[model samples]
Target: MEHLILTRDLLNTSLHQSRQIDFEIHKTAANVTRINHAFPSLEAAIRNMACKCATFGIRNHVDRALPTVSAVFKVSQVVNELGKLVSTHSASDLNLYLSLVKRFRQALTLLTNTCKLAIPWVEDVKLFLLDGTTDLGVGVDHDHPYQSNVCKTLHLLEELQGTEERSLLDQGILGVAFNKLEDEFRRLLIHNSSPLQVPSYLFSSGDEESDASDPLPPPPLPFPIVQNLRAIAVCFACDNQLDQCMSIYIKVRSTIVKASLQGLDLGYLDISLSEFDSVQEIEGYIDEWGRHLEFIVKHLLELEYTLCHQVFGQLDVWTDCFSKIALQSGIQGFIKFGNTVTKGKKEAIKLFKLLDMFAALNNLRQDFNRIFGGTPCSEIQTQTRDLIKKVVNEACEIFQDLSAQVELQRLTDPPPDGSIPKLVSFVTEYTNELLDNDYRPVLNQVIKIYSSWYDNNKFTKRLVSLEVHNIVKSLERNLVTWAKRYEDTGLSYIFMMNTSCYFSKHLTGTNLGDLMGESWIKRHQNHVEYYATLYLRESWGKISALLDNNDGDVKKRIRGFNEAFDQVYRKQSGWVLCDRGLRWETCQLILQVIIPVYKRHIQNYLALVESEVSPNKYVKYSAESLESMVTCMFQPKLDKYENSTKYTNLMGKIKNVVAGRFSPTTAAA
Candidate 1:
């Protein structure tokens, strides 16, 4: 027992010395060189201690051999220190440092093998060796310092007796290191407070122009965060953990989207455009939000395509989130927004905004296609087109309603201007502006709607032409109704002629004119000509009928003819004949149709009257005086008539009879 106790005492002293050397080595770099010189001596002492402990029968001494256990733990401590020191060695000095490492590792192996009793503290040495081999660090750049260290350590570990143990250590250390990196990234995201916030102007003010020029603020997170994330992704991809790397990427992209949208005030998205000041305000908000979305998606796709396929394999999570977020905050929001902005607005204003909305949708679809470049935004495009169709339909409804209201007002109220109605000016201005803008899409849609109403199964040019024809017919009906409202037939014909001329001239000048075709325009012109002829027939035809000598009573006939001529002349002279060309043509027709017959009738009547007692009383005037009065029929200002050749020849014959140059028998011949 005394011999055994002395051996244990020597073993304890050597273990104490080994531990002291290890402490000295770890204490300073100056001692690392000095202590490393003492490692050979320390190795000898630990080797002797292990041999003595092995001779003591480790199993038999397990309960009472506290010193034996302390020695085993001491060897573990020494091995840990040596591994750490080896990690710091330069490549040139690595062989020398590793020589010392080899001694300590050998001592540890001998101690464990000789003891035959498992030391719970032995795990510390194994873990230290694995860590030295892996060079795993908890810091941000975990792979930087440890790369060469891990290579060297793995090379050494592979040559060791415990291949299985080294493999297990390799896996465990890699997992822990990767997990540390993941946790750090997670903490970074959790702590990031740079989510975009809604601008105060978006919700608080109604100034569209002010908002339109408002510059978009930069994203909440700095550029470095993105760089760091990408670095981590690259590292994971390098490690062949692409799935895990993709997951991180997905999380990062989601966070970016979330941050951007947080500033958009998504709750206000459901608000109608009327809640704001104007369509421009809604446009500003949508554009602002769209810019942010565009920025994020652009960067994301750039990052994605730039990465290798192995790193970014058909990642849809980012795109899916983008689509959802953008639609929720932009397109869907605009549906109600469009309605509210256009609501209660003037028809022209409503048409402008709705068409502008369609333009915006077209631009957005193009942007989406340009950015995503695949089927990613296909659904969004389809939805956008559907929204455009809805806006177009709404615009058509507004147009139809405006037309109805104008027609209603025309029917219910007299012309405020007392000439052509205001509806003409309104329709004229509206159509001119519409065509001037070249809104062919709006025209096409309107035509489509009208065609659908006419015949759903057939959408031909004929049907569209018929629709236009119907619109003209409605106008004609309105004009005729307006004209007939006046009691005087001559005045009524003048009103119809004037209104029809104005309508036909304006329609022919517009794109609506093109759609109506040349034939339609000619039809309208013919209608104007028919009205002019009707005016002549009503006013001048009565006077011409009095020129007939059908009545046997010459005195009654002359009295009646004189009365009718005076009545027609007074009524026509007071009327407004607006068009100069129409008035001239009307004057020519009256002179041509009535002059010769009037000359013959007056010659017959005056021949009988010339023999009476009171010839002057019997005949109202001489033939020349009657000719002068007849010439003044349509001339309100005594403007000279430039009669055609036929009118000149006819007027000459009448003049000859009135001047007594031709006998009544000769004039009749």
Candidate 2:
């Protein structure tokens, strides 16, 4: 075009030079008829030359006009094709829909570039026309004649093809497309979402090394679904409908997240405090809550978070979407259950459940913080912390209450057979379990936070030790009170021995023992020994006195000794020493005193009375028989008391035999 303009300028300059030469020639005088004839010829020649130039100009205009008109026709055709494609395809065919979106975006970019070609200056337009090298540097005038013509052509093309409505049409299309995508997203989530059963490994001992070593990333959505959703998200972002995109994402996924948790079927999550009549009623729920909490934080919420990132990572809404989903999901359900458990009846039995929950939360604290670290997730994080605190505080209260209950237990009756009391067994067993490795640290944490036990963050064994010690001491005091309830002083001693023996045995090799220390064990053992000695003194003292050499009438002494031994044997045979070693020791203690004195009193002194009075009369039991009888003592039998009649009859038959053997007539014969 610049060359054409320059050539036209040269032609015009040549014509002007020719015209001036002709005019100068005419100025020189000549014959009038010759001049007129010459003028006519020159005029004809000038006219002819002018006509040729006009013809050339017409050809030049046609040359420029043909390409412009054809280019416009081609652009119109491309616009019609794009409009038809965009209008024909349904967003349900997300693949084709996405392709159309891409094509449309490209077209828009092309139109934008076309609009930018609004260069006003002829030189700039000529430079652009020559080689397309000129930038024109930010001073393009849209109102220029050429620019307006191009825009009018474009608008005309749009009007012809209904392309002007394409944006509004595509907006409606995108709206429906996103709506369909929203449904598809929801459907895919629900269909693919299985209740992420917390893996069994997570429920393991919660060792820090184990957990850190086996760090688990949240599981991913299916590959196809992720790709599909990602494409949709990018399209929405390109179209500047990201807010609508995110709204759909958050709304659909939040519902899905909550539904997935509900599918866990932890019915206990729904149980309210008012509905729970007892601690036991809520015990199972608390266990489920702990497990469900692990599932939610480590599995379900993690999965949701990862899904959001995968689908919306290209957009800015992933974090916000995940936070909304987590809040609506049952993360709150888990935390709320903890609150309920902590606020329920503050019974000692509930402490174990509370500790279970607290321990679970403590274990998940890392995961919880990492997953819920977003600014929008503060409520969940704060509620979770508050729940843990409440659990610890409640556990401490119940533990202290348990101690008080133990101290105040006023049951007066000892166990029937002088075995361990049920109260002692329960308290010791419970304390042992509470002081276990898994639970003890949590208990200590509770005590540290809620009580004035150790007064620092350091975990001192003494904290739990003091707790167990207090519990044991309370139990011991209760034992003392209960032991006094036995009518027989010997039975009272036996009961104390049984209880102390139980305490020592139970505390021998456990966390409770480690906390209470060997001193506690030794003290209980000593109590057992003291009680045993007291039992011996109370039970066998009179029998031993009867065998003492009083130098009084030997017959009287023999008779008194026999009767006292008989009375004691009948009475003590029904008693029970639960521990086998204690039972053996008790029987041995009785025999050590009995056998030596009996052998002496009867062997030496009874010989004098033997000739006058048949020895069988005073000493019906020989030393061998006496030892056997003492061994049989303290062996518990259900029918022993009922069978006392048989014992009395046997003693009567033995005495009748003695009388027969020592009758006076038989003695004379």
Candidate 3:
């Protein structure tokens, strides 16, 4: 507080530039002359003031008995000097007064380190104190004074060069400034105290006429503003250290750009028969994304499949709660926060390259696919598209942060490259967790989201792009092999005609026809009811015709098909007997009994039970059955594949297997 006042007064007069000097002494002398001559510099002024300070007989004392004016007038002077350095006017005269601050800093350090006082008013103690009393303050906090003196401000490390040659950033010049500041900070740190220190050779020669090297120095007083200066210095040091952060940041930006470009260029190629939610126009089935769509579609399709997975009953309760949290709370909050950020960053995003921008978004959507599934709908795509449209930001959501970290790892060093064993090791841990942990609710959530969003019932997202291409190629090759098997041959042709006459309606369709035999649909359709009675009446006759006493294999095969059909209609959704011309939904009136018996003709009797009319309701109740039925519904689909030749050939394989196993003719002989 005392020195601040002195600094305040001197700051006004330190504005006039006298001259520049090379060495520390010349610099100090010139500024000292300014003060003695009122030369608008603090060093000259401080030297003159020190002379006057000694003449007035002022001693440095905060207590005891010295008169205010004579005991220590220089205490007020030192306060003023400190004030001047921090003052606005002294700041305005920065270049002219910098040397003065240097010298002034030196003088204070000399006085404090030497611990010697030279003043006329008090000589009682050898210490620098006015009367060398031991009292500082009864109630003052030590850190208080240091805290009060701090002044904070920003200082630029690099000033721009003249505008003429600037096309891009001048990293050379900018880097140098950062390097210098870093070096200065390192040097200061060696002293182990970050406090601003003045070098100690600037004090004036005192009362005796002595050589410049051997002079009695003028009295020195330590300045009390070290704490504030230290804080400012740290800010400078931090700026210097972080200067190189941009270099790495720009590199990360380019990698993301490259990925987005690749994905976008190939994203929309069409090879699928199904409609695409994102694409508006198409020329044939050959679009931009091409065969890659199959893998994408496959992963998407997997979302729809309800498999016999090992469910986690142990984790049901927690998993349920977490699912609710994810859907109802955390994700909702993120949606709100994310929208705000996206809105704000729209302008900045415009500056990024379109391809790079597209690539980044597509990459992110890929991550979502990993969590959710592959056939993301228009709504989900819109959400994803919105996300993609946004500019890449420095601050990230936790998920985004995690995604970035994962991508960083993938791009920087692919894990599988060096650790196939690690992958195998990881898979075991993963499998164990899924089997043993309480992931039931989470598992359900995952399935639900994946089914609804990621899976398009066509393919999985994991198989997108290149994988899709391979799959399509493999599928085409299989079709060619199938075509070769249908060439006609021998009396087997007569049996094939008989089978086709009975089953041709089942096997036929686009891809479906390629899969099943003819009459696939007719075999299962009204056969449940239309042929139920007739088939039942003839069951024993048909059984006798097909199997003799030695035909154990035929009996077993028939038993298996019977068991599968019986089990489905027997329990959960009981089968009903319905009359002809009555739709399955009108079963309440036509069908008298809901569950039917498999007494005579098991397969035919079981097929005719009518129940669900609505596809949705049917799906809800008969999902498992629908999946099974579709497995066989391909009969019509396959029937389209019908050639008497292929049928005869397949029957030949079956006949060979039966002959190898049984040879009942030999037993009879």
Top candidate on lDDT is 2
Sort the candidates on TM-score, descending order.
2, 1, 3
Greater-lDDT candidate between 1 and 3: 1
Full-model lDDT for every candidate: 0.48, 0.62, 0.27
Per-residue lDDT over 1-669 for candidate 3, one digit per residue giving the tens place of the 0 to 100 score: 323443453334222211111232254344434433331232233334344445333223212212322212343245235423422122223333334444444444343322223222123211222222334323223243311111000000001111111211222212222333333333222222211111122122222332446433221111222222233233333334332322221222222223223433332221221211211122211222212232222222121111101111122222222222223212222223233333322111111122222333344455456433323233344554454433233111211222222222221211111111111112122222222223222323333333454356433332222322332233233322322333322112211222222222323332233323245435534443443333223322233333222345433434543454345333313111111122232222212221122122233323433443532321122324433442331122112223322232222232222221112221111
* Residue 629 of model 3, lDDT score: 40
Report the lDDT tens digits of candidate 1 across residue range 251-312.
55445445555555555446554422434334445544434334334433333333322233
- Could you say which candidate leads in TM-score? 2
Q: Report the C-alpha lDDT of model 2 over 445-528, residue by residue, as the tens digit.
A: 777776554345654657677767887777778778877787888888888887777667756776666677798789989998
> Which residue pairs clash within candidate 2?
none
**Clash count in backbone of candidate 1:** 2
Better of 1 and 3 by TM-score: 1
> Each model's TM-score, in the order given?
0.44, 0.66, 0.21
Using lDDT as the measure, what is the rank order of every candidate, best first? Answer: 2, 1, 3
